[model samples]
Target chain A: MHKKNKPIIVLLFLLPALVLFIGILIWPIIASVHHSLYQYPTFSDPGEFVGFKNYIDLFNKQYDFGKAVINALILAALSVFIQLPLALGLALMLGKGIKGERFYLSVYFTPVLISAVVIGMLWEKIYNPIYGIVVKGAAALNMSDVIPPEGLLGNPKTALLAVFIPTIWQYVGYHMLLMYAGIKGVSPELREAAMLDGATDGQVNRYVIIPIIKPIIKISIIFAITGSLKSYDLIKVFAKDAYDCSYKVPSLLLVRYAFHNAGGIASAIAVIMIIMCFGFAILVNWMFKERDLYGKK
Target chain B: MAKSNEISFDSEMYSVKKTNKFVSALIYVGLVVWLLIDLFPLYYLFTFSLKSTEEITGTNVIGLPKEWLWSNYLRVFKIGKKVGASQVRLFFANGGLERSFANSILVAGLTILICLVAALMATYAITRIVWKGAQTLNSIFMLGITIPMHVALYPIYVSFSKMGILKSYWSLIIPYAAFSLSMAIMVCTGFMNDIPKELDESACIDGCGTWGTFTNIICPLMKPALATMGIYIFLQCWNEFMFASVFSDEAHYTLPVFVSNLKGSNITDWGLVGAGLVLATFPMLLVYVFMSRKIQESFMVGAVKG
Candidate 1:
């Protein structure tokens, strides 16, 4: 309901959001690329331009960014292979018209609603070596040797798995809810038709229901992958220093360097993170599209 | 021949019913197992919060506390009192549990305010007005949904440090509002589309300027959408740990940051940290208990639209 040539009012309306968007998100990305190419010994002095040194230094033994990225990739793999399947199973089960469907849905989602910090702390107490349930239970069961004296989080061997368990536990409900919504949207006529052909529950879910929900599954995969790559909160709770930890991720290194006068290296890590997140997102989308076409044929 | 067919069909139905009952019974068992796994940790958090330090570290690992000591929760508020002339206390001086709780409310409140006003105006401009480049601007805002906040962290850290607001509320508020804008705008625009164009037309016919129409006609009808967006935004700001920890100091520490620091400063007090965690999570649990459906719906809306 506007007359022509009211550009001023439109600009006014859009300016605040656009400015915040660009300044906080867009400009930082551009600045990250620029800053990555320089050695910022400190923020005050944007020292001499050193082309790809910062990026290369990331792979050096000292930074070990390559390992961090690998760890993140492992987490992403776990989310897709382990976490997403569990979520889908739950969603499929709940979609079958259970008795307390709403109750189950809300209970499953309680973990996702709680902050990662709180979840991390809760898990930490559970993992506490001295009086933690893990040690106490192990002792009660006569398998005390399984846990190291320093605790699961203290040992590099088990720390990664220990940290990832709670992280995965917290978000399973999230993906389940997403897939559950998708399943709920499936028309009952389609299901009844499938059953009319004498298809069992497993077969209906595998062939009929899954094919209909591929797009949502694809979205969930993208989210799962991207979310894992940028995972920091829970992992941070386990690894306070970021360095000298087995469960290091890119964001941990990014934060450490950002405040430690290694801004160039931090910016490089940030740039790589942006690239990987966008890259995986595109890759997942394309892969799903290809499968859709193949299925049609 | 017809009687024989009916007899076979009856036998088949009986077997299917037996299998269905068995399968559903198995499914119920599985659902109950998962439900226990989900609720156990939360139950542990609450019970642990009421345990004494002695019980937490000694004889009582998993069971309920022998004698419930609510004093653990009281100690959570008195965190900074014992850090005498220590480096952690510099940041821990005013960094009590209560201070951080207030700080979190202020940061989250200001963020919601900023996002609502900015996103509402932007949604109006994009959906209602006939401006050149509106499509382009809308696309730019939409592009933000995919951009991870990590990309902006360091640069915003740099810029905010230079502006000398790195340790202030703006440090968290500005970025929180900015990061929240895309989803807020998306939800608003989605809702705004359903708002009939005739309302704006009638307002214009009644001599209402663009501003007048937005204030009088559109804002009131957008309440449900705004409420949905408000809860979503509140959760994001409240649970945010990264920027809150980095940008805010002891004086401005939010709940997540405060609870995290509680562990560090009070190393031996597991029960106290549990109390702090409970305090941090209590608001969210209350929200979940009351508006679990709305919270779930908000996330669903954002996901589908994104």
Candidate 2:
């Protein structure tokens, strides 16, 4: 709050949090972007500011930066596709009057309770070729001869996808809970009326339910997309020994660059990531402008 | 032929009419199947944590082991090695993850306590203070959610290091208190909105000051939201990997950092790792199981305000 005589008190209340946010968050973001201008040094400060050199380098696919960006986008898109649809399907199913719905919801959601590192380790051990569960299970099924010995995590072909699978799996119940809440809030009379008109289960879900829960869908998708883009911990843990520091999606990409590589380019990557996420968020919101569905219009 | 066709058609119609039961059963079956898929890895870890390494290697990964290693929990409490076993005092004691956990608790605890008080005071001003710029404060907080914490880590680290508090708890505690303000304020403001301004006015007219009025009137009414925010803040601090990872050393490692650190070479003690995970996850799970209903309701309440 601000006023002529009240400026001091107002500033007193406002200064601490805002000042820290600006000092710590905003300034670093600005500094991080600024840092991207220079040629990175080996063991010292940035040697000089070549105005667009790092940006040029990134654009020209120097250091495999372009690949990282593409990988990040694909990871986000893949996660959104997998996590949202499955979660939405579960949300719709459970939102139906299943007798033991809450129990199932909690049970399905237990994975979310554990740390990301643990999840990564568990899955990685399971995907270990020599002693992992999948290979052993295949051997047990007497199909070991038919399949290759390479496990998903070690195979470059399936490595990203293998990592992505758990990233998607972790959030299913979280998104399901969000979507279910949104679905539950919808008036059941609409569904009942649709059914009374001899509407099939498909028709009820398609015509009435989807329209009502569109915001939840958008919110869930936003989270899924953002989450996938920010998926670092799992991959970091899962790919512990084998993971090259630089070979990853952008969140980890930026991390590797900043921690191991210098700051300027990493800052650029960070800025680009924030923009990409916010841009995608805005686009989704624009696309799913469901005001009329919610009756606000 | 006509009589047989009629009989088949009637039976088919009867089956179709019972579709809800069929679908519900299918849903239950599908749910249980998915539950098995999702829970097996975690349940395996839990079971494995209770087993010795020998048992883990001998048995299938899916089930209970021959003997449960109940001592692993005790092992988690002590350091595997102490510095200079000839036992001289060192700059750091290489023992007691429980000590580091206590440090985390102290940092998170004090930070949250301060955050709650400060946010309560500031949020009151934003909602109840008859002045301009209130909207700006609120909007800044809403925008704060989108600003990634990593962006803030650099300056905070540099500044905290400059202040000679790099390895100290303040490195994390201050930033946490600072960064988590936006979330706390938003929730606090929302709770404040639900309590009508007339109560504040009446209290003011009766000679109560701002702090007194907040302490007496506003805080009590906001219990549900406060409880929700408390859990949110606790979880935020408890599971925080970044700030702790960057800021703290071995002496101050939070549970997340400890778990994150188990990825070191020669640290292939998956059994100990499993034990650590159970230790780290169980407290949060305990809170979740008891408070899931309230926590779920809290989100709905927040959505209404948003």
Candidate 3:
């Protein structure tokens, strides 16, 4: 408790985490940027200093990094527009003190606890062409013609959407729980007051609950977007052995290149991913702040 | 005139109540549909895991298996043995469900332990200690939350290789702990801020040293937050695939990687894959089932507070 020893004691406590944080996270980003500037293919040999060539090479067809970016962005968009709304709907619905709320919450959130690999495999079986649920269901309904024989994940055109479906489904409960917590934090008096003013349930939610939970919505948006950009596990399961898979996202590309001795290109993708994630986080916060001001007006 | 107004208002209320009932019914229906969709895959997973290979490959994908084959689970554990072998070994000499399960537990447990200690100390310092540059230190740690983990993947890989620790438990444990530190610190600090400064002052008055105060007063009070964080760090490490896949070789693959690798090799063996999936899934699901409230609270608290 000595005043002079305070700083030393604090330093002792903070040292381990600070060291690891710098060693693992902060240094890596710096290293990634440095690595990106060179033609470094692997760690053993420092390849030629290629300047911004790796960054430039990323957009070209040879790397298809541009396509990966576009795919990641598209996934981010779908997450915000499709996934968040569905989650919001569930949150709003369940936030109303419904019966079996805990049951529903656990059921929906079960996927979040399970490994993405398991979820991928589960969906893969469901989408299996021969004996999967899709084919069987279509056959039962006498609509087998509508089912894709090659399976959804196998088809290039449908692979992205198919993969995105499970990706989105896997986390619907995550965003829903976030919003649900926000919704529950909204005072009952506010809802009652709105109802006393002759507002409908929808009206009360729109005017009273939604505004109160806007901060949470913003967080969910940031999470959904950033999470989509960095998504790899489930997508990897779907990719398996496919070369140039249609659903290649930035993380996938980063992994592929990193393993294949394209360390510079991989670092470029990593830098881009970090940039996108941070950019989206800042943009979402800014958007929310701007909207808050407008709403006040 | 007053009676007429009252009657009209009552009628309006009745109609609104009627519509509310209808809407509530609609909402319940929607929730049930969502619930079914949410649960169906898990249901299928369990049922498929129970089915024989022939039935799984047959056209009865959605139906109950004619004869429930608990043997699939047995075979998952009995990796090198024949199906329905009388003497079943719990620990497979070959890398199978047991090894992967043990690996996942060890890696996740160590990661959580290391992360908690580091994060707790850092959080206590940042929140409780009044030092120069404390605010800046806090900001630096906070910045880690937004840095995508993949950015660190190559650097970490290269570093571990250089250090000759690649494919070892430390490689996974180090990064897992480091990556989780930001959020863990945020959660811990947020909780620590709530414990009144009076507690520390009182401890000091009792002639308690800083270490003593931290051990007796701070650590005890930190149980709930620590539990929440433990579940989180455990789940993150358990469910983690990216680092595990990259850092771990065959001998050290965690459950997720093991399950996925099984899928890759035994591409057509849905039953065996389902068994592997079940093995990977049920442990987490069991943890979630018992500790759902804690898990959910931790996730929400971590997000909201951060």
Query: lDDT by residue for model 1 over A179-269, one digit each (tens)?
Result: 9888887877676667667778888899999999898899899899999999988888877688888889999999999988899999999
Candidate 1 lDDT over residue span B66-136, tens digit each: 88888888777667555565655544467777668788889989999999999999999999997678888
User: What are the per-residue Cα lDDT tens digits for candidate 2 across B255-296?
Assistant: 777776655632556677677778777777787788777655
Off by over 4 Å in 2: A1-5, A39-46, A59-62, A145-150, A241-247, A290-297, B1-19, B71-74, B80-92, B265-268, B297-305
TM-score of chain B of 3: 0.89
lDDT per residue for candidate 3 within A182-285, as digits (tens), equals: 88888776766676676888998899999999988988998889899899999888886424788888999899888888999999999988888899898888
Fnat value of model 2: 0.27
Best by DockQ: 3
DockQ of each: 0.54, 0.35, 0.57
Task: List ranges where model 1 is wrong by over 4 Å.
Answer: A1-4, A290-297, B1-19, B81-93
Which residue pairs in candidate 3 have backbone atoms (N, alpha carbon, C) closer than 3 angstroms, thus clashing?
A: none
Which is the winner by lDDT between candidate 1 and candidate 2? 1
The candidate that achieves the highest lDDT relative to the unseen native structure: 1
Interface RMSD of every predicted model, in angstroms:
6.3, 8.1, 6.1
DockQ agreement of candidate 2 with the native complex: 0.35
Isolated chain A TM-score, each model? 0.95, 0.88, 0.95
Ranking by DockQ: 3, 1, 2
Stretches of candidate 3 above 4 Å error?
A: A290-297, B1-19, B80-94
Candidate 1 lDDT score at position A124? 86
